[model samples]
Target: MENHNHTALISKLLTCVAACENCATECLKEEDVKMMAGCIALDRDCADICSQAARLLQRNSVIAHQYLLLCEEICRLCAAECSKHQHQHCQDCAKACMECAEACHAHHEPITQD
Candidate 1:
């Protein structure tokens, strides 16, 4: 990836992580938290994966491609799940997830295969 893309992707990844964290936190406080179990789980997973992916990206790791693949899938899933609800946090998270997924997918190509 070019320097610009790398920077943008990292920003998107961090946005995704923050969104996921916020979504999960809000989901836990929902009246029917049990109904959001899956969403919460996905949010946590997506956040963690995006965080790791961002760190790997910063280091220009060859294996970041794998992390991007995983992050894209999880972010998409989390977005879909979040979109199921009308909560503001979930909606925001959905947007962030979609953006992150797009960035990750766009830059899925492997770096130098060290």
Candidate 2:
């Protein structure tokens, strides 16, 4: 991958991590925490995957592309869950996840062996 493409995708992945963490924190503060359980769970999962994907890509790991596929899937799921809520944080998270997923998809390529 080109340096520019790596930078762009890594930036999006980091942005997604921040958004997911913030959304999860804010959701916990909501009065009906029980109702936001799904959102919170997804947010955590998305954040973890995004962070891992970023790290793998940063080091140019052989499996990074494969890992990104998983990241994209989790981001889409998180976006869907966040979109179901009316909170501003949820909306922001949804937008970030969608963007990250798009970047991941655009950058995805056939896995190469070492």
| Candidate 2 lowest-lDDT run of ten | 1-10
Cα miss at 50, model 2 (Å)? 0.3
What are the per-residue Cα lDDT tens digits for candidate 1 across 1-114? 333347888999999999999999999999999999999999999999999999998987767776788889999999999999999999999999999999899988644445
Error in Å for residue 104 of model 1: 0.7
Worst 10 residues of 1 by lDDT: 1-10
Pairs in clash, predicted candidate 2: none
**Candidate 2 on 1-114: residue-level lDDT in tens?**
434348889999999999999999999999999999999999999999999999988888767887888898999999999999999999999999999999999877665567
lDDT of each: 0.91, 0.93
Candidate 1 TM-score to native: 0.90
Q: Estimated TM-score per prediction? A: 0.90, 0.92
Q: Provide the lDDT at 111 for model 2.
A: 59
Please give the lDDT score for candidate 1. 0.91
Compare the candidates by TM-score and give the number of the best one: 2
What is the lDDT for 39 in model 1? 93
